[model samples]
Target: MTVPQSELQQIVSALQKSGLTVESVEDGALIQHGESRVALFAEADHQGGVIVRLHLDLDLYVEEDSLPDILMGMNLLNQGLDYGTLNLDPVDTDEEGEDSGVAFAVLGRSVLWLPDLGVAELDRLREHLRRFEAEVTDAMERTLHGSKGLSA
Candidate 1:
């Protein structure tokens, strides 16, 4: 179920052709689109399917005191999504602990039948990523500015 090297190459090529700057990693690539950057990798799962993991870091650094409100907002956002999850990522904290900043991110994945996939399949994946990116960006903006719609 692992994606063939050919498919992987196709994925990278498609991204590049779409105007995304891509950097190859071990099994996938890092893609930059406007201010949104994502890392995509394909791997085989135990069920014998290729899973493409799409990860985008929501780099909104908020004050510790605002983390709860932001998390709440993200939870509300997640409840409305068909794909991906918004999460409070712990890796972005500084040594100041609570006095420092907090971070959030969006992660999405989809399974594909490698033999049946082509440019169209890649386009679908890209569309999903684009939607996730927009939602995460808007959610972060709402959280940081204490948008009146968000509840702590």
Candidate 2:
């Protein structure tokens, strides 16, 4: 159940075996589950342990007036997370720069060590995704409810 030391390919295989659609992108692996997509990257750190980073795109757009609410929700969501965080980052809502003003995207980020994978099976990893999704969904419904920043 252990993966090759620092080889992301084994991690990709683990994800695939877990019934997730995974693809190796230029920098990391992209795992798609239903409508959610997560990007994973792992590298050997100075401590001799692999550093793992997981990112999920919530795709929740932010508006200027609702920035405060979004920030508040992000903060609250972070409080309940295990190793992940909800962040508001600047993004182009309009690809062609038509008329969409400044927009921010709600993102999910998690960091863990390779040993944390526990036999390299990625059970904790999958749990992290589900936990992140549930918490964010709840925060959006109650914490950031009625805010103009979020879209369906």
Candidate 3:
């Protein structure tokens, strides 16, 4: 028999309480909100604090040859964020990476740093998650499409 990490379990419970579709996995949680699906995990830092990370695979895919433009767009998107990043990487559409035009997807990652993250911090996070996701989505759209979507 094995025991789950208490910290991660607590975080999952809190996120769930916040009305998010959170499923507790071995080392983290998977959340689906609206049209966005997000994965969340927590780890202990070298400084004894905890680092909570969130990730989502965006729906946009582009050819690998556009790496330069993609990188520049991601940089521009990240520059508008409070503390998050937008990145792109090749996606293996098949076993041989064939029949594809160098497909890639934008990945969104956000981190929460806390020395004493617990119920209280999670309570605060519940409200912020909405804003966080919205902010990232808006930034991505504005940077990639040159349209103002929303504001955080």
Best by lDDT: 3
The most accurate candidate by TM-score is 3
Model 2's alpha-carbon lDDT is 0.70
Error of 1 at 81 (Å): 2.9
Give the alpha carbon lDDT tens digit for every residue of 10-115 in model 3.
7778777777898877778888878877788888788887788888777877776777766766676678887567777778775564555667777788888767
Error of 1 at 18 (Å): 3.4
Candidate 3: lDDT of 83? 53
The candidate, 1 or 3, that scores higher on TM-score is: 3
Query: Which residue pairs overlap in candidate 1's backbone?
Result: none
Candidate 2 residue lDDT tens string, 4-59: 55447767777788888999999799888667778888876776656778888876
Model 3 scores a TM of 0.78
**If both were scored by lDDT, which would come out higher, candidate 2 or candidate 3?**
3
- Local accuracy by lDDT, each model: 0.65, 0.70, 0.72
Following a full C-alpha superposition, what root-mean-square deviation does model 1 have from the true structure?
A: 4.7
